[model samples]
Target chain A: MVHKALKIARVMLSVYYAYMVEYRAELVFWVLSGTFPLILMGLWVEAAQGDRFDLTPTELVQYFLAVFLVRQFTVVWVIWEFEREVVEGRLSSYLLQPVDPAWRHFFSHVSERFARLPFAFLLVGLFLLLYPYAAWLPRLDNLLLGLLATVLAFCLRFLMQYTFALAAFWIERASALEQFWFLPYTFLSGMVAPLALFPDAVRAAVLWTPFPYLIYFPASLLINRPDHVAQGFAAMVLWSALFWGLNRWLWRQGLRQYSGMGA
Target chain B: MERYLKVLRLFWGTAIAAELEYRLNFIITALISLGGLVGSLFGLFLFYRTGYQFAGWSWEEALLVLGLFTVLQGFSTTLLIPNLNKIVTQVQQGTLDFVLLKPISSQFWLSTRVISPWGLPDVLFGLVMIGYSGDRLGLTWADYGLALLPLTFGAITLYSLWFMLGATSIWFVKIYNVTEVLRGLLEAGRFPIAAYPAAYRVFFTFVVPVAFLTTVPAQTMLHQGGRGWLLASGLLAIVLALLANRFWRFALRFYTSASS
Candidate 1:
């Protein structure tokens, strides 16, 4: 049974590999999307120059660079993909297979990350060599932990966003809701800046939210050993369980709706 | 001139009629737009809390920049973006043949195809913010009017550049990625150009030309920064438009209709 599941995962990976090859230009385009975060890093580093915050300028550089790395690895297309499949009735295609649809989707998500690894590695090396402060980056073990946390965070985010996307099956309009969910995540996820930079009240609010676990915690884990990696990972695991439950519930409900078993 | 006015009038009427058909959607979109404006203003407010001045500009001056950026962004949403954004799908699906077959200029048709009149609220909100900020900053009406002149030219330049980006779909089958790049570049407009370092300032002023779009307008109004920079931007716009027009023509030549 384990072997069969591994085979299924392999097949899913091959399919995504084929898709990526077929859309090679898109892969290049997606890599270029990393440029925006790098630009943000540039602006922040300049702002931090000769100015002391709680962290040094080099520390800020390491922080954002780590963010760029983790963000690329933790990316998922599940929200948009889930919406498209559900709306277009393509979920039926997935239902025909013996494997769980969510599992297949998650497998595809991981496969895409693997595909991005080449460019992601190249960017990391380039950033370290080219940027002013390469020495400030965390050690290799911390880097591995950062990678693990980021993977868990990606799974958590996927479950949450995919659950949100399943609302398309119920609502006539889900785009606004999807946008609402995403726009706040940009601020809250520490994509634009560290949650620490936020006002204390706002930072406190964000701590309980799932957003920080997505980008900030993993980033901080890699850049500097904050006093909170263990705590944040615990939070991420808890949220992951909750979101997984919510996703299972929603998927079951969505499937019933699809099967005309719901009012 | 009369023909152009007639086209504008016709497009305006159709847009209004289309908007009125789904008043609920219009209302929702308008409210969302207002929400977006508030979010943008709040972002500016956050930046202000950090310091009295950023990169040599006062907080109120920065507010003017935000207000002007909002206006330009509104203009895009209201006029150019909705219509042009669909160009890729239309081209890919072979529906652009209908557009090309029209008696009017294809550029004119595609550019003015869909104006989201509901987006006018953003314009109003932006103007209100600009007016209020100017009052608080003690800037006179003359400054605002003088600023408007260059900005008018800047707006046209920007619209033309964006249309050119959309027009590239005729050649490159997957120009959506290119459009995504532009969207990414638009984030650069969120902060004042001066706040950014020299590298970014040059890049925005020259490469992306966002400086011409937002900062120049705000600078003119708040600081009365001379027309020298504005004229240079205008000249750059003219060059870019001319090149874009040529590129458009080149792409048109490669267009074998995807239709059967």
Candidate 2:
């Protein structure tokens, strides 16, 4: 079992390195894409106007800066990867591999996020230095919970997105499907604005959905008050389990369809 | 002009036929798109409920901006998406050579290669929203025309900028995130430019051009300004388009295909 696991890990790691080498320039370009968030940060800061919002202007600044950092830390690019592989017949290469293709893809996906950390941290430090308020925003306990929540959030997001991609097995032109999934998540995932800032009904609705656990939970852990962290963490673990089970069921059904082609 | 129209007609016809092969997909996808539109509006509605106006513009104005944004996005997806998506393969595999050898302008042909007819739904929806907003905001026809002209110009500027970025794929070969960055930046336009305050208004208007892309155009529809600014922005788009064409030609020289 150890030998098999190590072999799979080694192969996926090599694929990750290969992807980095091939797309190094694209990686740099993506890192530059962080500029938009910074621009939004500046804009939102000025608009807040001396603690005009519920939080102080500095607090607003800290919120967006944390958002930028957490987003960079947790962003996933697998939806496109899965869609492309299926659409372009590239899944054949993965199918030939001895280990499960989804597992290999997940490892590589995690590696990409890991590889991006140095740059994400650099930006976080810059934000911290420029806006000292952000550095003091998170308590140690919440920070720890945030980190743990981020891991679960990543797993839940991966499961949900993988299921969405698996739907491509049965559908053609999956871009619309991908877009449909992404657009709502953009709002509910707390990428647009805080769920707390959302109307009470909207906030309740988002909380009930799995989307907030993807990004909002980690972001809220950092930005929200200390009292809110434990609740957010509990919510995350619950959603993670729900999505994981859903993903497992979908994968099993999808595999059945694949094997039944011969039957 | 007639030739261009004919080209558009033929391409759009082919695209619709191709897309219609999966007709249920159109309904499902459109329904999904409607869900997204509703979600966006839900966010906007929540913001409005808290206060009468955000920054300076009212809900009606914000909707207009969103409508313009959706229309431009539809235009890009319908016209440029299919073509620009192939840039990586064209460069990596050297299949761009086939495109270059074609009788028409390589840049034009390559840029307009595939059209997604379904994208028209977004454009239609955008027009409807703009009309509804104009009526609610008490905008006159002259004001609407003024706004439409600049928005048309802004849309062209957006297309030109995308063309330049897409052309960069000839050299970089893997800048898929370029479009994503554009999309992300454009998302800021969902709210009024005033919502962001002064520096952001400047950033959106001058630097990233997001204001011209949506907010300013939407504002013009509400009679925020006469046609002068819109005309100037339109002229700016023409110049940008010229520059993009020049860059496209320059990038072509660097296109050593992976396939070759």
Candidate 3:
């Protein structure tokens, strides 16, 4: 059964990859649309001129570049898709399928990464060429661990958003709820700034949340700071499991409610 | 002009009534807007904590720029974005034919058909923020009056840019993603244009005109610059509006109904 599922996943990945390629221009635009990190990078780089944040200007550039790369990997749009499907009664079709619908969404997102990789590499190359001073080579061990952490981060983010999307079963404003979640995520996940740059108390509180494991931990690893690698990985696994369980419970309840309405 | 105002009034009244039927949406929208405001403030707090001057603007001046950004965002999201997004779907499903067939001007009708009144809270919040920041900066009524001309021109410029983007959907139905690019670039407007690198400042000023959208108004209110930018903004708006009108006519010539 595991082998069969793996094979099915491969097939779905390839199919979705082809679909993404067909819409390659739109995909490029989507990728280019994540310029917020670069904007913050500019601000921080200028701020670093006074050498106040303990990070050199080059370090600030590297940190934000890492942020931009990790953000592309960990981003999830399942809430939007799932909300639309549930609200439009399209999930009923998915329910009739032999395979679980989550696998389909997972494969679609995974395939998007595959489609986006070449363009991402090109963009990174151009950026490095433009700013040679910002370039830094990470240790091999750090690079490998960062990759692993990024994969886990992606899974954790996808499952958490999917769990949130399950709210559509009861409320039409699930997307608004997602927006509410984004407010905290933006600050806590180190998207706005490095967690270290935040005040001590805020950083301490943010560290307790699962948000940092999604972006900050992986970004830190990529930049060769493996101080909390073990703890971060443990927290990531625990959060992913928690979200998975919650998603399963919500899915079952939502299915019951959905069918009760005769959808 | 009176006829157009009457038509807009009728359309907005019905749209508001239809939207109010979902009373919970107002609460949700208010919450989301509040969240956005808080998030931006938190970011400003972090930036200020590092030091006093951000790209040579004081904390209060920076806050004023953020307020301007919020106002423009609220206006665009409530009126321009939703209406423009509808063009994508209309073009895709051939519903645009109905829009074009109407006796009224299609561009005017398409742009004003829907209004998300729930977004008014963001507008009010932004105005209050501007007032508070302006008062902190010791801005007088004359300063605000000076800012008004440029602010109006900025709004026209933004509307023209968005209208041009929406008109492009007639040729490329999937151009909705271009709006995402516009939104991404708009994030830069949260800061003063001078905060960015010189190269980025040029790009935002000329290519996207984000500087006109937020920076100019804030500067005028702060009494930092003279009326030259205001006149430039008005001229740019007229030129862009004419160009957008031309493009809309050109795109209409290529419209093939999906039903056919």
Q: Highest DockQ: which candidate?
A: 3
Q: What share of the true interface contacts does candidate 1 keep?
A: 0.15
Q: Which candidate is the best by TM-score?
A: 3
Docking class of 2: acceptable
Candidate 3: TM-score of chain A is 0.96
lDDT, candidate 2, at B29 = 56
lDDT tens per residue, model 3, B16-93: 899999988888888888888998999989878867477669888998889888888889878988798888999999
Ranking of all predicted structures according to lDDT, beginning with the best and ending with the worst: 3, 1, 2
Q: Between 2 and 3, whose DockQ is larger?
A: 3
True contacts kept of each: 0.15, 0.42, 0.69
Give the worst 10-residue stretch by lDDT in candidate 2 chain B: B46-55
Docking class of 1: acceptable
What is the lDDT of every predicted structure here? 0.75, 0.73, 0.86
lDDT of 1 by residue, A50-124 (tens): 463355667777778878887787777676776677677777777888877888778777877777778787777
Error of 1 at B105 (Å): 0.9
Preferred candidate (DockQ higher): 1 or 3: 3
- lDDT string, candidate 2, B1-260, tens digits: 67776886787688778988878776765776577678778767755665646666788888888888778877876876777767766877778888788767877777776787667777877778888887898888887777767777887788888778888888777778897777667777777777776756777888778777887787677666566767768878999989999998888877776746
lDDT over C-alpha atoms for residue A181 of model 1: 67
Ranking by TM-score: 3, 1, 2
